[model samples]
Target chain A: MLSIKNIVKQYAQHRALDGVSLEVEKGSIFGLLGPNGAGKTSLIRIINQITAPDQGEVYFNGEKLNPDHISKIGYLPEERGLYKKMTIGEQALYLAQLKGLSRSEAIKRIKYWFEKMDMQTWWDKKVEDLSKGMQQKVQFVATVLHEPELIILDEPFSGFDPVNAEIVTQEILELNRKGTTIIFSTHRMESVEQLCDSIALINRSHKILDGKVKDIKNSYRDNTFHLNYSGAFPAEKAGLFSIVKPADSENVTVKIAAGKTPNDLLSYLLPSIQILELKEQVPSINDIFIQKVTQLS
Target chain B: MNKILLIIQREYLSRVKKKSFLVMTFLVPALIIGMYGLIAFLTVKGGDKKAQVKVIDESGIFAGNFKNNSSVNYITTKESLDAAKKEATESGEGFVLYIPANIESDGKIELFSTKKAGLSAVSNMEKQINDLLRNKQLKDAGIDPATLKEIDPDVNIDSIELSEEGEKDSSAGAAYAIGFAAAILIYISLFIYGAQVMRGVIEEKTSRIVEVVISSVKPFQLMMGKIIGVGLVGLTQFILWIVLSTTLTGAAGKLLLKDKIDQVKTEVSVNEAGKTIEQVNAEGPAAKILNAIQTLNLPYILGCFLVFFLGGYLIYSALFAAIGAAVDNETETQQFMFPITMPLLFTYIMSFSFIVNNPDSTLSFWLSIIPFTSPIAMMVRLPFGVPAWEVALSMVLLIAGFLFTTWLAARIYRVGILMYGKKVSFKELAKWLTYKE
Candidate 1:
């Protein structure tokens, strides 16, 4: 678990982060969401201790964060970089060792990851010689090579191809499954819904939203149902439910009126129409994200 | 500390492993040796260039007195001056000397030739005519010409350097060469290794690698690692050059001059007494040169060299790293570099022109004591033998200089490494200096 309290970071002319606070539960995929220049990177950098905050305290599992905690954390910056002239294996080992791994351990873990990622042939190839996506794979493997308790990846999938992105996603899921806390900032709402368990949305140096992913979606949901019917469906007015035009021609979307349950609507419409499908429409994370961001903006 | 060592290892290994480093290391010493060999070759061959002179002395008293030597072949002619000039122009290989009948009263003479001769040739003719005239004057005055030759004295001042220990023969030539070489060596190494440290820093920042690396190590550690790493590379090349040049100078010395020297010794040995006197004059300076070199406290000099070498690299590289971090690319670095390099360039010129010539002067003394110019100026003073206290003071100031600049540079580097896209000015850099880590 990680807790950031009252973090304030000021640049020359702008305050990159202002009085921001968030808590990430242990072993959860925490999505850090923000628009451009919203202090997400500043918060991430503060967490990684790349830059110290002007005034704040970061506690890891109830202990104040210090240099010792560096071993417990791994950070992969969004704009990935490696020594262009160095071999892939050497570069990986160097990064792993910098995170406090022993030489032999770094080498072993690097080899295993390279093999798993189908990069065994790239061990001696310089970073400049590799494709951008291949380099991204190497960067990803290096990020997790030390097996830290918390992994912070900033836009890890930005330069990755679709297949490579899926690979990264699966690896992140596996790492989280094995009790690793992950913090990734992304604009990809689809990925947030698919992978994140909890999220904190930061906007303009302020924490505007924070909760469980399912709870946030559930809270944003209304009493709406997507109804599809066949044979003898009434086009006329209904008493219990209001019919809304479906964006598509074949399906009809309807909202249940107040003080009405799904059973009331089902009973009201079952006699006249053969219902092919009936499902409650829960808001996706994308819809909740856009709606909240729009409201806040 | 371990991480710093790792960074150093990476920097040092990456550079030392390059083929360019290997080639440059050996090539520099070889080129220097070849240059020295060429100089020695020219000096010996230049002395032996054969020349001929046809003398038409109408004065008749000096016709047979001008002797013939292997280097300068003389032929006394009876033809008129006009006919001799014609012959000289047709020949186009040598000069025709004209000594008129009134040459004894008027000390004027002329050389007529189609081809231009060097000043040494003209001076030789003057010496011959002057000696003949002088002997004739002594004979006419009823004085012994042999007694006058015996009375003439050649003044050779035996230069002795006085120290607390005692008097020792001094060779100005040796002192100048050694001092100039030391100063130049420091200047070159400072520029080379210092720039390397800056380029390394710029590479990390421009490529955005600093953020990832600094996540685990402090910015100070990274900077020190790079400075020390490149310093080691410079030291390695220098040591190799020293060893290689020593060996080549000895081998090439013999290889370049053995046959020519033998031929000159044999041919010029016919005038045994005159040639032996010339050798005595040359031998005195040569022996004094060896004595001067022997008086140099080499271990002491080497110790001071090592200290100032690292000290100079550290001081300059600290600023270089800061500049690299502040700017986005190499071109942006030019404006910032001028201030840092100004004093270095000034010290270099001062070492060559003023410091070595007058090491005991007040200006040279102050230049040696100042930390910024001390590396070159002090080394230049070292061969001339600096006082113990001044040497120690300069070293202490250099250590202080290293500490202060590194502290200042670190403050700037910590903030500048993370900055991008902005054109940073000196004002911005001054502001960055106050930023906390």
Candidate 2:
């Protein structure tokens, strides 16, 4: 669990982050969404303690952040790398030790993770010898090697292939299930729809929307309906309700007016058409995302 | 603190295991030994070429006086000047020396050869002819040649160094050699190791691993770890070089100069028994060198060398590491590197003249007190016996200098490591220094 309050960072003439705030809950997957140059990285860097904010306070588990919290927070920067000349096992051990793990404990955990990822053969191989996707996995292992309380992944899935991406997704889910708080920034709204429990959308140095995914979708719902009929055509007034899809004998989708109730609409159309099915349409998170971003921009 | 150690361990192991490190550590001493061996080999096998000199001697005062040594042969004959010159060119064997009839007054002669004669050959011929002409002149003046030879003296001034404790019969030449070598060694190691620290920083920045590293460790810790680790690498190489060179030199000396060294040892022992009654030259040259080495406070020089070497390295390497962190590539490093290199270059050149010629000069005293040049200047003066207070003051200032630069460097490194994809000017760096930790 982590909280950042009123973070402002200034770089030369550029205000990288202007008065942004965020909170990451325990045992939940939090998606941080923003467009390019939206100060997502500046916010993340403040949390990771890479660079201090001009005016802000970061709290870890309800205490002021300090150097002791470094071991508790794991950061995988977007532009991350390993020492190319150092072997995988050695570099991992060195990094793990830097995170406060004892040498023996580091080696044991590294071996387990390497075996689990099917990367045991790369233990003695130098990082430069690996392909981009393979190196990403190693970096991932390094990020989570200490089993940190909170893991911050910046663009974790960019360089990975689809298969590797699936694998990483599963690993993230697994970590969340094990009670590790996760905060990841990405542009893939589809993935966020599939995986995120909560999200904070930042745009143009402002937090426009943030809440539980299902609740936010509920809030952005449009008055729409899907209908399934058995026998006849509904001789409804063309101006009353807009037919959303091409007419079908067994099914139809429609958008009704805001003032009308579903029961009132059903009663009004029951005599003309044999009514069988009626369902309200709820927008997808992607639709809400696009709608909200366009509205704010 | 423990993280710093881990970082240091990683840096040291990663570099010390490289193939370049091992190759250079061994290769340098081998090359040095090879060069020294070549010089010794050439000296032992002196020139064996035989040179012939034909004299025309129109003066008629000297005949059969210019003789032959092992390498040069003198041929005196009563031949015409034209015949001698023609024979000299066609024969292709030697030179034709023409001593004019006015030689006893003029003190000048001409020699003709196909190629320019060797310096040693010409000087030998001149010595032989001049000796004979000088005696002839003395006899004509009615002054006995034997008495004139008795009065001719070779100057041998005994150089005694005056010290606060007492006078010491110290060898000025030996002191200069030791002082010069120590000063040069300090300068070379500082540059070598300091550059290594900069290169290591540049490597980390380019590789982008520093981002992840600083998340777990402080930037100050990272910089200090790297500088200290690389310094250890340089120290390791230096110690190995000393050990290897000593072994190599000893083995080579035994193999090539066994008979010569043993002969000198026996003669050295005989001179040692009569040292108090005899002048410095009465001892063999080798014996004098051995005795001078014994009189030197070698342990003191060595101890001070270790102190100043590390102090100087720490002070300069902080600047180098800062420069490395400020720039993205080696090309961008040039602008900042000039200011750092100027002082080092100044001291290296000064070691040959200012520091060596007068350790007590005003400029030398100031140079030895300023932290930038003091490491070399102080070492140069230390062998000649610096006052204890001056050495102590230099030590204090050097430590302060290292701490100051290290603190400044860490400030730059803390901000600069994360900055990428931009040309960082000096103004940007100056702004970074004002940033808060």
Candidate 3:
């Protein structure tokens, strides 16, 4: 388990992180979502021990984070960094050793990862000679080759084509399945919907929303319903709820007013048309994200 | 400790494996040997050729003044002076020595060549004329020529120095050569390798690789690893160069001298005569230099040279590493590097004075003890002698200086490695020095 509690980071006249906190359970993919400059990087740096927080503490596996703890955490920073002059295999092995793996162990792990990623032929090539996507693959291998207890990937899928993105997505899931807790940070809500078990959303240095992926969506529910019927609903139904859009066919989506229940909405719609289906449509995480961010803005 | 060792091993292997290192290691020594060989060849070839000149004496007093030589064909001309000058010009070979009538009384002689006569040739001709005049004076005094020749005497003086151990020392020329060689080695190594450390740091910082590496290792470890690794590379190259150049120069020297045995014998005799002449000719300059080198303790000089070289390099390299970490680019590095490198330049310039005034004075002791100036200053004093206690004290202080500078540099490195785009100034660096974290 990785726990970051009440971490506050201030840089002179500006407050970068304002008492932000989040938890990532073991063997789960946790999404940390925020708009640009939302203190996501600051929080990541603190967790990675790149910089110490002004006032905060992070615990990993019941012990306070320290230099010793850094060996057990694999971090892929948002801004990609690799020594351009170093060969791929050499760099991978070097980074693995720095993460506390012995030489033979590092080589073995590097070979295994290279074979798995089908990057065996690229082992002897310089990083500068490799394309951006290929470099990202090498970086991914380096990040997970040590088999750390916790993995933090920031914008891991950026600059990747769809094919390569899918490749990384599969690898990320495989690592998570192998019992590595992952903190995945990105603005891609679709990936969160696909992979994240829970998430925290920060806007303007404040976490406005966080919970289980399903629960957060459910919590932001406004009793919106999607109705499909044979005939038109009553004109009075428009007065009972805020009509989002009325379809040209006999289908419409409506937001029920405050203090109004779905039962009331259904009762009002049932008598006005031959209803084929009247389902309460739960909003997607994307909808919830935009709605929450726009409301704060 | 293990990580530091690992870093050192990687640095060493990676650099040594480079083509640039391999080329320099082999090429530099070859170049030095080739240069020396070229010099020896040119000297031998030039000495084999002799300049030929013809002489003509006009005045009866200067008759028989010319010396006969196979190379220089002396011709006696009874024609008028204008005819002799025309003959000399037509011959296109040698100059005409025109001695005016009663030249001994006038004390004036002239030489006319198509081109200007060389100084050595003109002096030789003048000496022959003076000898003839002296002989004429002897004949006029009614002295026998054979007796006058028998009474002429030439004296030669041989120089020798006794070492403290009662051994005859070699020529002071050899000692000066050794001293110069040691000084140049120290000078080149300190600047070249120290700049290498600085440039390495700047490359890492500019590329932002320091960010990732520093996350795992302490700044002190990184700095030490770089300095030690580069130092080892330098030592390796130096050893290789010494071995290669020694072998090549020895081989070339033998091959060039192999067929010139008779010439070598003659040259050796001439060299001995020349050394004797130099000792008697130049007053006491050669003897003073011989005494200076022979009286000094050789072992102490070498030991102090090694200590000061290592100490000064470490101190300067530490400051370079700090400067590397402080700035983001090479342009910014210049602002700091000038101040750091000034001491080295200053020490090299001031070294000569320290060698002359007092090799064991308080000033020399202090300069050699201080790590910044020790590399050059201590070396200058070593050619002269220094006390054992002074050498030991200087070593202790230099080591201390290296440690303190390393610690200070590591402090700046810790913060500077992470800072970016925030142009760090001297004031800011001063503040960073006080920063506890």
lDDT of each: 0.85, 0.84, 0.77
- Order of quality (DockQ): 2, 1, 3
Clashing pairs in 3: none
- Candidate with top TM-score is 1
Q: What is the lDDT of residue B302 in candidate 2?
A: 81
DockQ of each: 0.60, 0.70, 0.35
Candidate 1 Cα deviation (angstroms), residue A21: 2.6
The residue-by-residue lDDT of candidate 2 on B4-72, one tens digit each, is 888788878888999999999889889988977886676445424567788888888877876565346
TM-score of every model versus the real structure: 0.91, 0.87, 0.83
Instruction: List pairs with backbone clashes in candidate 2.
Output: none
Classified by CAPRI criteria, candidate 3 counts as: acceptable
Candidate 2 residue spans exceeding 4 A from truth: A10-15, A225-255, A259-263, A266-281, A290-294, B47-116, B261-296, B353-355, B381-385
**lDDT-based ranking, best first?**
1, 2, 3
Worst 10 residues of 3 chain B by lDDT: B274-283
Docking class of 2: medium
Which model, 1 or 3, shows the larger DockQ? 1
What is candidate 1's CAPRI-style docking category based on DockQ? medium
